[model samples]
Target: MALLETLAVVFAVALVAAVAVYIKTKLFPLGDGEEIREDVAEYISMMVSVFYALVLGLCLVSVWDNRATADDRVQAEASALHQTYLLADALPAEQRGPVREAARSYAGHVVDVEWPLMAEREPLGDDGWTLLDRLRTAGELRGPGTTAQQIAAQEVLAQIGYVDDARRGREAAAEERLSVVLWAGLVIGGVLTVAFMFLFGLNRSSTHVILVMGLSGFIAFTVLLIHQLDTPFGDPLGVGPDPFTRYFRL
Candidate 1:
């Protein structure tokens, strides 16, 4: 959703909540002790606060899980590519150099070229896929030599397949984000929860201000935290190319 639209929705929610509470207070003044339905208000406020907290927790968990999955994809891709590099040693002498170079080129492309693209949520193009295909071709060119060589070649192909799968997953994760509905829930829930605090009549104005300040600040912090973590390969809580660097020593 657009920023202005989101802000408008939040404002409307808070305004409605404030108007409702004001009417309730006016109809059943706590000071007059006219059978005040404070119990109902209290129940409602507690429920809003709890559900706001629950929504915050759910968003946090969702982002954290997405980040973890992205990290796993990176690790799996790097590990499989590393294994492919190692398996190059088992190929026949003529095939060894080509296979090793292909593996190195692919790893370098990932670390130097593709990592930045993923971080920026940009398309990586077919360069990566082409590189992977080259690695497969290099392994295939072994031309059915010895038994051990054949087995190693098979293993190399398997590792390349693993790398391909992980790369696809990584790409998918880069474009992933928190749902707009969840974002709306977060904002509306937070506003309502804070707004409900106004329903209660505190003896001390300072106490009310302090309580509102703390609650609003906490809600803002959590929402911002979730926003930062929403992108699988973006800032503060993003998955990095450290796995590739670690595996390939890039």
Candidate 2:
């Protein structure tokens, strides 16, 4: 639904701009004496488009890499937590329940609480780390009595270490954002690219409308794509709780 609405809006804007440009050409046809060289105009338009494409490609790559990093961190964190959960069964009977409960609580907190904060780009409190500390404490409360229990406890601690490292990465990724200068360039370059095409339009009226509208629509779509990718944690683009649900059944 969101995609449909966005496409409709972009197409509408492109249609309107094409109509306006077409009307302008009819109202003020270029005089023979005022006409610029067609080759020069085409060269200028091509350069503007190339420069704009460079900026667009940079922005797209920046956001896409950030999004991929965020997803990777999520996968690592969930995997480590799942390892922690599995190691609990090897723990002493009394310690097993607390450790499992701690793992479940940690998973729930991430999915139910921390995820929303990330989606909103909100500052995360230390509560998540605190839960991690609790999990560590829960697992380490009693010393392992047997050699097997010792190995299990040590492995569990190592997995928790992985979870902590991945959590840090996730936090960093959540704060990732595209630079303001790039965004300014994106907007200005798009406007200039479209404006140049409008200025040096085609001779055929129908062809002019088609060409201009197609360029306009494609540019609009690119801008929208950049914006969507910029918000790696937000809806319509973000990876959800699938990793957690897969392992912990959250």
Candidate 3:
């Protein structure tokens, strides 16, 4: 099943369970009013809440780290592209325009074509790298440069290498999948926490308790929504690299 579908099923089951238990408890109050009075139940519920909070925090951090890493990689790649463009000045006059044109074309392809697809978690096609190879090869050093200049050129090219590798890593990071066990833990924990709330008569009045439940449910739903969108390259809330689009000058 799709991730969304699986999530839907989890929530459906949890909601049914919560409502069913709530109704049953209301309709037929335990004679002794002691369904969860035991110390063991209290301890277990507290431990579950703590574990859920930790897991939620960890998942949020992991997703945020992935996004931050991707953003940094893109920035580095752009910087390298810019440096490579500037390096065209070092090439012999006959090679300058072609190198510049190739760099521009590569950047344009990345911005116009690759960025959107990446935002949607799509793999970049082989063509981008093909263009990169052509561009890199376009500027051949015919004769030895002054040692310093040669070193500088090599440094710039090294930066280009970094950009290429980093971009690939960013793309791979976007495709990273959230662990299914974590999702299971979130769903189960949420249900148990909410159910525990119902078990205890926290709200003196039914209306207040129902209000709390609805509000809590909404919060849980929002967290789950973020989890769904954390892939940003995924369907719901993926971040696009359109920020670099204007450089295309196309």
Score each candidate by Cα lDDT. 0.86, 0.87, 0.72
Residue-by-residue lDDT tens digits, candidate 3, 118-166: 7666878798889888777765555786665576567556766876887
Candidate rank order under lDDT: 2, 1, 3
Q: Is candidate 1 or candidate 3 better by lDDT?
A: 1
Candidate 2 per-residue lDDT, tens place, 87-123, comes to 9988899999889899999999999998999999999
Compute the lDDT of residue 158 as modeled in candidate 2: 93
Enumerate residue pairs that collide in model 2: none
Error of 1 at 174 (Å): 1.4
C-alpha lDDT (0 to 100) for residue 36 of candidate 3: 53
Off by over 4 Å in 1: 1-34
Please give each candidate's TM-score. 0.84, 0.83, 0.74
Candidate 1 lDDT over residue span 1-250, tens digit each: 4656877876897899999989977896667546646798889888888887888888999989888889999999999988988898888889888988898899899888987787777888999899999999998844659998999989999999999999999888888888777888898888789888888879999999999999899889999999888877877778888877887777
